[model samples]
Target: MAVATAALGLAAVLPGPASADPGSEVRISRTAYGVPHILARDFDGLGRGYGYAFAQDNVCELADQVVTQRGERSRWFGPDGNDGEGVNLASDAYYTGQRRAGTVERLLAREAPLGPTPELRRMVQGYADGYNRYLRETGVAHLPDPRCKGKPWARPITALDLWSVIHDVNRVSGTRQLVPEIGDARPPGTDTATSVSRVPGPARSADFGSNGWALGRDATRGGNAMVLANPHLPWADGALRFYQVHLTIPGTLDVSGAGLYGTPLVLIGHNKDVAWTHTASDAEHGSMYALELAAGDPTSYVVDGRTERMGRRTVPVTVRGADGRLTTVERTLYTSRFGPVLSTGWTTKTAYTYRDANADNLRSMNTWLAMGRASNLDELRTAQDTSQGNPWTYTLAADTSGDTYFTDASAVPHLTDAQLERCTLPGGPAEPDALDGSTSACAWGSDPDALVPGLYGPSHQPELTRADYVANSNNGPRYTNRDAPLTGFPGTYDTGDRLGLRAELGLRMIAERRDGSDGLGAPGFTAGTLRATMFGNRVLSAETGRDDLVALCRAHPVLEATDGRATDVRRACAVLARWDTRADTDSRGAALWGTYYDHLMESRSPDETGQGRALADAVRDFAAEGLPVDTKLGTLQKWAGVPLPGCDGGKGCFNVLEASPESGTGTPTAGAFGSSFLMAVELTPDGPRARTLLTYGQSANPASPHYADQTRLFSRKRWVTERFTAAEIAADPHLEVKTLRG
Candidate 1:
């Protein structure tokens, strides 16, 4: 007992909330599930409400966020936190190494305050103060540091951290725009061109995709319109949505649903008269800058025609242990207008400039929060108008009008080709660079609201033309296209494999339900899951996957299509498809295809298909593994739990990404993150009745019964009831209660 106390007590001596202050007073009401019904008066109050709620469910993660956003990781991570010189922290190194840190930093330094009115700025700052107060008032001494040890204190919070987080949140307001650097490329005649119509750069790839839609009067049981939320994210922090809440400030606000950590408001979900869900969108919302070095060496560049020496800023990074002495490893950094120039000790010393709509996107969130309380399209559009951060947005909204509208959103930058050519720094250019921020109109000034061609008025945002509307895995800002695709690489657009298999099957199911009719109601909405499953099956049915892949079923005729046993089969099938029509993984046929792609990189000119390349790599890697491919999706795909490991236990168990196990790369055989937080909502005469199902439910803490308790319902594609009314919450049996005040 003495030894344990001594060890635990030392944590108290560590640094904690240095700027702790009393935060905004928040009132909380709890139902049976330990979920809170919070009421806050205004924005700051809401921030307090959120910070308190997040702290309750995930104090450790919340604290880590504060430290990370503030860039004060080393204080908590110790000497080994940053690179050798001791600067950043674990998340900082990994996040930045992935080439996004400078993106966040530059956005803040150069762009965050772009539209902040003094009032808005103060409100944001107040929210930060309130958050810090929560940390103080709670007297939270030590927080769990899961990434690295020796750091126990909660660190600190600041007003700018709030700004920084919101900036990042809204910057990624659009789905695909979130990581433009990594998305599936559009072939010349795809749908994206009419959307973004502006920013498109070197690297374009898509990791995976999702499917979701709304059913009107025609397909429901109760004759009410229904909206389905089936978002697919790699089960990880900021990847999946968490912390569901029902918030009401009455006249000021009354909304319900979920939001991810780090973000202040709900990124996606529903309110009273509507439900909004997002899949990836095919929009070119990100831009890369061409950076030039300062007046040094032969590569010296000229900025503003002034010989001002380029500023060399070095950023240090950290590695786990140093020489077994329990320390860190660090590196230096340099930056330019195009942003930081980075290297991973590889041959590619690539110089790139990247920008997103996320930097000053606080308004994007402001509008979302406002929509929670809005009752009509006018009010919703009002919110949409103020969504300053979302540059290329694909927004779909359903109103009481029985009308659905989808608008290609964002303040599209209008940079001229001339500007793109001249604004570039000293680097490479015979014809000049793709875009130089200063010279290119694409990179700068103009009414961002003006560039979107069709975004002018009513028809610009089209909704469910028929009473039954659908938005499957297209991730596109387009209404269903009837005409054939046009040919051309029009600037500011993404044109590729825009439509996926989901759209094919979703439209089929909708047609069957309505009998080619309109008016979809509640009954049709309730059968959403059935529709999804049927569509998935029907589409894959036509494209006879691969003969060799299907034949593997002969080996295990009566396959147990449950959990990992079945999941392995799918992985095997996915592998076989990559086999170049051969049954064997290591067949000469497979190598033929492999060598083809390899030679293309060396032999071909500019390789345009980032999507094709990524997908090809994934396939080829699986083929090299020498494994039999199976043909059942469910047979080899199952949700595996992502377990948080203890300090002394084996390395932590975490999310199961969709990757080929045979590749022996990416995640292990685990697949914990499947469909989480599935909700089917319908607007009825009585109001809104929602069926919500969560896989690995509400609590991130594994110890809670809520953890994985919802797993069964998730697999069945069923749902547990969710009621915003006080009376309903009172009825839940497992209701746990906690009082939160700050």
Candidate 2:
């Protein structure tokens, strides 16, 4: 990433003069597994150390992201290049449009409490300067990762660029989902090259799943608070990769845990008195509204007996052509008062627009930093109530006071029952009905308590304080605690009685251990026991369907396959009968049962022949890969040259390692997603005992010694003991220290 002006100073990148002082200093200590313990005097120095250390490890990825957030992907790369979100052209146009609208600029212009405080701004500036310092010292050509070495797109980044990255994450569940649609939207009959109408609405819920458990003293064997954070995110090397670090400012700040690649906050982890984690929530953060367009004028819509003209912004993207020449392509994007107009569900007679609850949410980092500084669960809840900045996740936390708390206080559209009943139109996406965009009567309500308008206040969202436990596995808050079901929230919040397979399995795991039925020889959980159970790799689908499937195969010695041929099921039935119902590495027939379950889910019907064919196909797939049908999972599924112990499909595996084909082959050689970072934290009286493991290692650069160290430990189901205190930091034999002055 090349900066257009190499001489742009750090002061220019910062918003104000209240950034890091001229002689700001920071110290970074690297413990085992190359985890950095950064000590500074204040937030600015802390962010400086963090940003410098993070760049030392992940400069390539961060630099590429700077280009991405700047809407220069089409310029630096090509128009068709994809950065895992959408095509380059669409991403460029979407962000360029936002820049033109001055959205982020207006956000920064707000007053302190609602916008960014001075401390936050200073920290952001310090981070930007720290990253730039690293870049200046190392020189772009000498960067470790050759991919971005000497690349023009890998230039020094600004604090505003970092802010854009933060905003992108806050809107991941909302506006980010409509990048292609917003970029390609056009007036009807004006463009013949439009393909936006064929685009799909937001997806990716299943891609982000997790099991978060917050256990109080009543559920703990040691009478202490325990939290288990098993977030199942993508294993691919990108923005979502969790970087473990311990940030400290003596008495002012002390926290240990992980944050995403390009940010300066610790998103999930533990402080001295509390431990917290997040699970992706099923609540809706945005709504798609149907616009009543005027006849023969797609750009004009009628609202409450009045004609309203849609807002128009023409965004031009500069693309690097195949011949290395730059050319400009322009598109006219439309918007209503509700929000940006989407190409999906748009026609000459009607159009669709979307409104995101988190569009202006800039305080999420404030909440996270507050959570890190919180001394107890009440403080945690207070931080939540005040910031209400959770983007789209449920907060499950446990404090040393033996209290467990759970809340879906994430940003959500504030729609009342009356408004829902009065403004519903059939066939909406995500929601049961598209909101009536024609009138202000259907608009989202506001509360004086809410920091943002058109969003539910923190008090209105689901929340609970329990002594036993609170757990969520990417499900609604209704069943956070099975014994005490929460209800009466609006449909937008996803209140319901039903639990998904993963949710049911997660709840059952807690109950069985609490009742001493899980063969763990205990009635309550200990940090050690919780860690063991997380890696237990129990496959619920196999336990429920394996026997029945085997019996069916036995009853029919031979069955018809999907190819209209006979498949012998006797061998499959025998193998399943003798197989252990777990997704462990050595479990025979686990792969076959996984295939059968996938077929059942897809067919959504009892197709006996299809099951037989699925089993047969599994066998054939193994044979094609030159392995036996009963081969150990460890022998087949390997990532980073280490055998991944968990199962491939979701398949009800609590310890999940979802896998995908290698170069389109049927054999899965790598984990594409699932179980990225696992942590078990216990707030013991002896100052917070915790263990964590990042499935992938610390650095994306394979040349780094830390690249696969933790990954190998994860393969063996091991963890790195967190070093939070100064003594623990000094105790590591592999400790290396460096200090920076600016």
Candidate 3:
């Protein structure tokens, strides 16, 4: 793999203000497997080192994110470019409107104490400068990645650009689903106020989200705390990718874990005394309001029985023309007191306005920094309380003291039950019903003694500290633990009641000993046991339902011979009946069963008739695709260009390896998304012992050896020991050292 050339002047020394530049103070050591261990004198130095190290590995990805955040994707990539779900034009329009509205600056100014502090501002500035320095020294010609080596989009970024990227990521998930609605504009009539409509929520997928587990002293072998952090995210997207790093500022800070590309702080990681991770929560972070528009003017709405004109801003979006020229497209965006007016395609008459708790909040990084600095569980809780930074996500943590904690730590809107009842549409609060916007009654934090504007304070969020164990598989706070589940919280806080298969399996694993005993007894959970369970490749569906399904298939006489397909289906049943219920790569019968399950889910058939039809459909589909009914799971779902075999456990399995049918033929399965990072941390008398495996690797540069090193390990159900201590770091034979000075 190519390393940054010496011609790039790695030792360049540029003098900045004395306070900002601590002269040759940032040192980065690349240990075995290309993980950077950064040692800095202070926060500013730390930021610069992190920025330089990360850029060395992912400059192209970082540059692409900056372009995407600036809403200039259309300008660089063309307006017709497909942005996953829609055209680049939609992304440009939405992001351009956000920038034109001065949302980031305004939010930064309004959010006091919770916003970026002077230290954070300096750190971000240092990060920007480091990134620019890399680009200046290693010109586009020296760029290792061919994807954006000489691309105009890979230009130098500024501090403001960094801030914009952060803000964009914070809200992009919720806004992406409303892109079409955001760009729609039409005239209003009397029917606009009376029409009933709802803004559709993003499709909920079991394939997404994460699995977090924290075992306390009582649940562990050595009477210590243990935690498993497995976050499921897209492996290909640069923005969502997690980079491993160990950052230290002497006595000020020392933490190790994973930070997303383009971010300055470790979003999920651990200090010597505490370890933490997050899973997407079931709480509603953003809401849509149905506005009562004026008879003639669609941009004016009725609020509190009075007419109010919607705020309008003309945003200029740059798009590349067919002739390779850049053109400016102007769009007029409308916003009501509730929030941005969104046009639901179902009806132009009713305009849905969107609002989220994290829309403009800038305290997320600071909150993470505080968490990293925490010395114990109490201090971690205090950090969460002080920043209230997380917009939406459930946080789970464990400490050296054998204390485990769980909380919906995001800033949620505090709406009383009475308010919800009065404002809720006929669809009820659980569904995506646009609340009546004519009165303040439906608006978030409208109560007389509301905690904050458009959000609930930390004191009001659901939190718990358990001495036994706590876990979540994105099923909400209701089922954090099956034995002593958190309850009594209002439905508005979390509408989900049932446990997902993954969550159920997690609880079961934690509650039982490795020897299959009922409870955590003499041989309880250790770091080894936790790691074993995390990669067990056991499918709950197969363990519980496969036998019955196979029996059902046998009982039903093989259908009349319609070609040889019927015989194949009977053979599949026999294979399934004899097969074990695990999803290891070598497991047989999984392909047949998985195909049938996918068809069953797609058909949404509940009755006996539906089951029969689904089975027949699966058989026909497999035969059409020319696949044998008894194909091995690995043969159908192996990784591309690699010998790494695939597994059968999917979506809601404890050892999740989610995949989807290949495009076009749709018989062979391709890995879609699953465990992006799998880490297990155990607090011991000596220190914290940790091991981790990134499904992909540290660098996005395909040519780099580190790009898929960890991925190969993950494919084989293996992990690399995290070199957290100085001794561990020193023992790495492949260590390379670099120093940075501003």
Best model number under TM-score: 2
Model 2 scores a C-alpha lDDT of 0.80
Model 1 lDDT-worst window of ten: 645-654
* Candidate 3, 515-621: lDDT as tens digits: 45643245688787788878776667777777777767788746422233443357777878887766766677776777777766776764555555556777776
lDDT of 1 by residue, 125-144 (tens): 55566556656665554333
Ranking by lDDT: 2, 3, 1
Residue 580 in candidate 1, Cα distance off native in Å? 24
* CA-lDDT, candidates in order: 0.44, 0.80, 0.72
Model 2: per-residue Cα lDDT over 77-173, one tens digit each? 8888744333788878888888888888788887655677677888888889889999999999899988889998889988888888888888877
lDDT of 1: 0.44
- For all predictions, the C-alpha RMSD in Å is 12.8, 5.8, 5.7
Per-prediction TM-score to the true structure, in the order listed: 0.66, 0.93, 0.90
**Clash pairs of candidate 2?**
1-152, 1-153, 1-154, 1-155, 2-152, 2-153
- Candidate no. 2 TM-score: 0.93
Clashes of each: 67, 6, 0
- Where does candidate 2 stray beyond 4 Å? 1-23, 82-86, 196-199, 202-207, 428-433, 607-627, 648-650, 663-671
